[model samples]
Target chain A: MAIKDLPRDEYLLKGHAACPGCPITVALRIALKALGNKTILVIPACCSSVIQALYPKSGFNVPILNIAFEAAAAGASGVSAALKKLDKTDITPVVWAGDGGSYDIGIQALSGALERGTNFIYICYNNQMYSNTGIQRSGATPYGAWTTTTWTGKKEHQKELGEIVRAHHIPYVATATISYPEDLYAKVLKAKNMKGPRYIEIFAPCPPGWRFDMSKTIEMARLAVETGAWILYEEIDGQFAFTSYSKKILEGRDRKPIEEWLQLQGRFRHLTEDDMKKINSHLDEKWNQYKKS
Target chain B: MKTAISLPTLGAMGKTGTWRVFRPIIDVEKCIKCWRCWIFCPDGVISRDDYPTIDLEYCKGCGICAHECPVDAIKMEREKK
Candidate 1:
């Protein structure tokens, strides 16, 4: 669907504490529209917790419970259980977390929740690093990208959180970016209709963390998908399928060079040609595996 | 140090327009009424019906609307002292 076709209902509200062109804000706005008012958000210690605004005056019109850094999944599970007992199953319980919470600290709780077949939506708005904590390097931080903790660059490659979650054979698992709002909206709508644990990892770019122009937030997200650095796909009932943008790339469409994506951000400014070559080869290896799958 | 706990006043704080180094100016003649600016504005300060109107009292002048506008109808003008 086109951008104009999106629902005009604004649940995120104005006067939010998010920075200019914050992709997470945009992502939440779109996702909440799809989920509607009957949604209860369980957010952990992340940007969302702070950006949701200070107490009683929440930026979100929906009910949100701010839990501990590692308790989002568990919190959502409890809420879902209570709602079920009260015969309010129509109210959707969702966990909105960041990369630090999802890929790192909260993984154990998330794993347990998914293992127990908790019915809720868990979305990790991955900005690549611990953006809320002064841009420290996290497990999701990409290799050769500088962070406060990784001054030179993270030596290791980024973790495959989507594949890790998919291994659980959950009812649904998908990867999306803020650039594709329509795709994200559709995925949220699809997940909302299904039962059991659902996970979607969104590549939400952070301007301050990634060291890029705030105005280029959408452009950066689009470049990541267009360059094939970040693939868009979904796994359902043990089957995997590439989404609209990634499907074209999987069909042998020439992706924009990785250099174009890398050069735009200051975090990758120190990378040498050899470093770029290594990153490119790593991407190619992943795409080759996708083709095989 | 003592900490104070209180309910948030919710947008009760002073206007954020003072924080802007650049203020957005909307050109009605050039506007095609796409509503992109209204949807993408981080602060939700833009209101539209027929043409877009920016509420400068809350607009942080993020330039997101200006950048996202297909017709470039919104321009960021330097904030005058």
Candidate 2:
């Protein structure tokens, strides 16, 4: 169904503390529409904790458990177990974390929950850096991107956390972005209906962290998929297939040069032609594996 | 206030509209009523009925609505001093 057909109820309320054109809020708003009121969000120390606004008042209409930086999945597991005990099978427990929380700090907790087959949804909105801590490089930060921690550009390639999640053989795993709201909506809705550890990673481009114009947030997200920098797909049980524009790209659609996506962000400004070659070659290798599959 | 549960309420962090440098103005004549602006608005300030009406009290003036609008129906204009 089209975006207009989605529920019109507002779960994320007005007058929050999110920066102008914040990517996290854009993604969360769409996801909450799919999640509805029966959702309890388990948020770790991330931008969302701040976006929920100060104590005693929150922008989010749903109940949120603000946990430590490395306790999102652990907290959600507990919530899931408690809900099951309470016979509230309809209430969904969701872990909404950032790259720093999911890929770096909270990975162990996430893995444990998955291996235990906890019935919950874990979504990592990967901005690729610790944006809440003023843009430090994280495990999800791409190669040749500048962060406060990586002054000359990050030499290591980003960690494939999605692949790691898929290895758990969960009932559902997906990748989405805010640019394609319907794709994201459908994926989250599908995950909500499932009864096992379901994981979703959304490629969220931070406007301030990526050093792009605030208005260009959605454009940056669109270019990411069009350039093949981010591939959207969902894995159900053992079956895997691409989704949305990524499926078209896999079927011989032309991929825009990664430079088109890289050049707009100031984080990639330090890259030389040589650096571009390295990045493109790395991306090619990744795509080649996909092409072979 | 001492309670651990923080029930969400409107304007929790106070009015954020004062942070705007450029406010988006919708051209109703050019508007297609696609709800793109309403869906993309981060703060949930834009409410949709027949046409969308932005609540300036918390509109962050991010210009995302203007940028995402297909018909160029939304324009980002400098806020009055």
Candidate 3:
């Protein structure tokens, strides 16, 4: 497909209260632009709920349902079901939720929707904390990161949300980041056209929450992917194939040390050499498991 | 003579954005003493005395110091442009 197919009229507009470098807003904008105007959003009580705002001033150009904290997937499923009842055929329902909403509170509803093979796009913008609730540590938070609940640094437990979603045998499951907007847009667009449930976990950077600079939002995302803190790959109905694996990163010829990425954001500043070794081993284990599967 | 610092190879943007040299210019007039920046800095590259000084050796072009300036004191403008 040509690049023009990505479209230009962004559904998520420029003015919103999101911090200067909130990558969730960027991912939403890119995803909506790719998904086009024939889309409806179900947002839970997370950063996007506030970012979308009240009745008339939503950042979204399309229809948006301000769902409850734990009902984004269910709300989207309900919307899809109601549309079918009304004989509607063309619109795409998108369930957008934060890390806390998806990885913890909304997992049951999400799993139910996926199990029933609901035709909807589930996009989880994982900034790894309950950011809107004052940056408390959540199930998605990485090891050695400092949050309000983990001021001494998070105690080495990060949920494998991607693998858990992949277990549902959705039509599509992918890990993407705002650092790769084109890839992110392309995946969301592909998910839009697919017939069954689609799940995309986007690693969005939260500047205020992560204690990062507004300008370095994209930098952090890039680092997250490069350092293997975040993995980028795609699975089509459980058929795993990594699309963005470059010669350098895969072959290790031109790979910059992962530390280059981590040293940029202060969230990982607490990571000592010992801690980093453990993280490396953890990521390697996850990667090898995916390969074996 | 100092060895040159290389560009980040993480390439999460898939080789999209180019590394244009950026230099931070801090306006002393608008300088806020809160230093939310110095506290959150990962690299210890920004040296704060009266105003913050960016030591390029450890500065990875993340622009955290420039972006975290609560006041309009620090500006991260393109060096060549």
lDDT of model 1 at position A262? 93
Candidate 1 has a DockQ of 0.38
In the range B1-81, model 2's lDDT, one tens digit per residue, is: 655888888998899999999999988989888888888888888888778889998999999999999999999999888
What does the lDDT read for residue A266 in candidate 1?
97
- In candidate 3, which residue ranges exceed 4 Å CA deviation? A1-5, A246-248, A251-255, A291-293, B1-81
For model 3, residues B1-81, the per-residue Cα lDDT tens digits are 964322212222222123326656778788766554443333333455676666543343446567656676877777664
The better candidate by TM-score, 1 or 3, is: 1
Point out the higher-scoring one by lDDT: 1 or 3: 1
The DockQ figures for the candidates are 0.38, 0.82, 0.05
True contacts kept of each: 0.27, 0.79, 0.08
Point out the higher-scoring one by DockQ: 2 or 3: 2
Per-residue alpha-carbon lDDT of candidate 3 for residues A1-293, written as tens digits (9 for 90 to 100): 43324454545433344544467766776787778888888889998877654433454567777779889999999999988888776899899899999999999999999999988889999999999989999999988888989998898678978889989988899889876666787898789889879999998888888886667776788777766667788999778876564313554534446677767768788788888888778777775665565
Model 1, position B38, has a per-residue lDDT of 69
Estimated TM-score per prediction? 0.94, 0.98, 0.76
Q: Report the C-alpha displacement of residue A49, candidate 2, in angstroms.
A: 0.5
TM-score of chain B of each: 0.84, 0.91, 0.60
Q: RMSD to native for every prediction?
A: 2.6, 1.2, 13.5
